[model samples]
Target chain A: MNDNPFSLWVYLSQSPLLWLTVTLVTYAATDAVSLKTRRHPLANPVLHSLWIIGLFLLLTNTSYTTYFAGAQFVHFLLGPATVALAVPLYENRTRVAAAVLPMLVALAVGSLTAIVSVVLLARAFGLPREIILSLAPKSVTAGVAMGVSESLHADPSLTAVSVILTGIMGAIIVTPLMNFAGITDFRGRGFAAGIAAHGIGTARAFQVDEVAGVFAGIAMSLNALVTSLLVPLAVTYLLR
Target chain B: MLEQIARVLLWLSLGEIAAKSGLWPLPAPVTGLILLYAELAIRGRLPDDLGILADRLLQFLGMLFVPAGVGVIAYLDVFKTEATPILAAVIGGTAITLFVTMVVVNRLGRTIAISREPGSERVEGAARDVNA
Candidate 1:
């Protein structure tokens, strides 16, 4: 056991894989805990999962890079995971065709809100051009967010955190908040989460109802398209 | 799991190609997705086995972020460098996006009632029917 790269002794000695192993295990377990706790919106699979993993990393004194090597395998899958979303959308094409107009309108509104409000407030607060660039695509998924960040000359890492935070927050608050606003329809609840939260919100929508999940998926994919175009263009032409 | 592994690798290669092409304005993964979707549309299914393959992948999608999440180390100091403004943008930006989505989507919901489709609102009623 002491010879294993991630064993307790090797871990204490700062094995590279130790931190990543612990991070993965912790999130996997925490996800279970959050799901078991009655599907609370606050459960936030990403938040709770990361919190659990971060604490473990801190306790072990293992650096983030050490863990990322092993975890990159999982990270690498995000692209394919996104591609897989096509299956469900295929299954729900009928619903998607029906709601295309409302979905498109919702996406345009959400993407604009993300860009305008962030830029206005960031400028009002006197943020640097770089931070403002990163903020431009914070509402989109990580894949698109990172792409927007790079094209606009912002820190992709910074964009990643903002995107993840938006996703987790959107996942937790969207449903009840939407119902409160009198949106009891699948298109509304799902699209809000999808356009706003991206993949994480889509996952949250899955637990609600199939209709919500379908629209959420479409909303997510379409928002990824629209936001990707809008964010980079804004930074290039408008913000500059 | 085996099929998923191969499929993912294929998708990654496809994504990389799209990203580097510079032919269109679209991002790589999205371009790959478009290609994949076109294939699916023409074929009328994403290779039957992909259904089960995708289900298993989605179940653990959260775990996949571990790599990117840990990369937060890369930015720990960016916080100190531009602490005040960065915090404002993240917190302020998130709040506005959330608020705007709620307002726009719900309003759009009333206009389109996008849930007019059968699948979205089928859960509760469907459950009761199953039980009965």
Candidate 2:
């Protein structure tokens, strides 16, 4: 009953290759929509891309496992991508050193602030401990966030949400807050976004200026380094 | 192309070893990065093709985050279980972290001479006094 070619794309619907295709096309469409219009903050490429991908998976009854296979192309690049960003960080070394300690301090304090606020709030609201723990340390990059969540015995999904929301919030607010604080330097603003927002924030920073993108990339690398270390310790020592 | 591939592979292996070694606190990726830099130092220059590969990779880096972003959908149970706390953690934590980071970095910028805010007369005045 099933035609080989016709059913192929349909059966492949659940294949990672198919899902990855859907994922990329979904993002491209959303990005086009955002660009054609006013580049609305909420219409963020990551956020909208996720939405379309999610809907496709839901409609097609495909699991994330099927998607990850194809999507690994993107994942595989993440390491190289981080190293590549180093080029810019090196180019901007003078500026990077200017606030190295500050960035470290921000990451530490930021990690703590992120974890504590969630746990305490969850406690206040009488939420389950697993969920609270999951929410902790979610402000970091997804890899770190997922790692932290797994280590903490929290749901990776919850932590993932916390991380993305934290990033989107940071991308949206960092500029205005910097304006208010009278700190409008592209490097400073970009760095702040990168540290707080992680990958998504890095993307948003690029939109503001090339300098922002450059510094944000630097900040992101540094933030990933710090949170990967600190989030675990915080859970083992303090949160537990 | 082969040389570029070899170097990239070299960098990846070095990073993996670093992560497995448990020496510095950085992740395998960071360790990988440090190794890449060291390789560059020894080689004295990264070839153009390698740069091109890296550049193309970086362009789609943002989209790479989407799969992880989908993790949010899976964590829907997390929302219900730790609703208030999760919100507080993300919102409060972000604002505070951004604030404190900016303060420390700004102050540090003043101390160092790489001021991000180049036109600020106050910071300029302070730097001049220090230089004088």
Candidate 3:
């Protein structure tokens, strides 16, 4: 069996099924820990999944391309999942509409704050222009953030990485931060998460409360639009 | 279930076309979200299956980004070269953004409530009761 051409390791390595299974299993395992811990912020499944899978790949010497070949199926679902945001939005359309004024005010101020703060902080820390450009859209979802990064002539992959890091950070901290601040409003909490952390933050909000999840979904979508426009302008005016 | 999946895919496809048209800079998924929302609004009701589907899939929304996130390993060099500024900007900037946005929105919530009808006080009460 060790010398056989059709050995299990050889076959598994060649097919997309292996990495796909690994991705699902890793997420399920980490998520179980998250649940058992009563959904503690420190038990963030995404953060856990990243390191676990990342280490597994490093150990096996598997290239990311090979891994993504199997994992793309899960990644593709992000599109449909995004579309499905409409359901929660529609379900709470009355509340969303009722809070439109605050949402609008929060959206503009929050969106600008997200961009300006990142750029200024990065510049203050002496990051290069290209890196600063990439960091500008780090708060938006990966897809939109990558697009904005490319448009700004920065590294899209770096933007994707920062976007995920931002998401993980946002997911982990939002709960304790909000609770400590005595924020009892799900709408505000979720909206802030969506703006600062994107989908992962929205996921965290959903785990906490349905109302927060819905509002987070709205904020994530809206911020994608607002951030795309603001990033370029901020890049220009601030960079100059 | 199949119908719900098709409904989502249909909107997503339309969103792709809209995005490719370059009339808007929005991502296809964001466009898809808007299109689906408009559809639900026009229909004036959500399909039960779709709601169930959204809830199920979205519950694992964090998982979906793991693959691309793992791709970050390839660019670990960037982080290694500029760990301080990068970490500071991503961590510090996100924290500030979250704190500012949350505080501002929460404070504005009161002003917004006062601006509404007398009956709208219940909205404020409901928000307070949500995680209280």
Best by lDDT: 3
TM-score of chain A, model number 2? 0.81
Candidate 1 lDDT by residue in tens digits, B4-54: 457655765776776687666666556555666666788886666777776
After TM-score superposition, the amount by which residue A148's alpha carbon in candidate 1 deviates from its true location, in angstroms, is: 2.5
Estimate candidate 2's alpha-carbon lDDT, on a 0 to 1 scale: 0.68
Compared with the true structure, all predictions reach lDDT values of: 0.69, 0.68, 0.88
In candidate 2, what are the lDDT values of residues A72-144, reduced to their tens digit? 7776766767766655555455556666766666556655565565566556766666766776766677777
- Please give the DockQ score of every candidate, comma-separated: 0.43, 0.34, 0.62
lDDT of 3 by residue, A62-132 (tens): 89999999999999999999999889889887777778888888899999999999999999999989899
Span of 10 residues, lowest total lDDT, candidate 2 chain A: A86-95
Best by TM-score: 3
Q: Write the per-residue lDDT of candidate 3 for residues B1-132, one digit (tens) a residue.
A: 999999899989988998899897778898899899998989888889999999999999989989988998667776688987898899988999898989888888767743554544554466554432
Report the lDDT of model 3 for residue B34. Answer: 89
Per candidate, the number of residue pairs that clash is: 2, 2, 0
In the range A1-240, model 1's lDDT, one tens digit per residue, is 555666666644455465556656777777777668756677756777676666666786756766675566678777787777776777777767776776677788887777777777888887778777887788788877898798777888888877776677777777656655555655567777787778887877776666677777777777888888787666666565
Best to worst by lDDT, what's the order?
A: 3, 1, 2
Q: Which residue pairs in candidate 2 have backbone atoms (N, alpha carbon, C) closer than 3 angstroms, thus clashing?
A: A122-B85, B15-B32
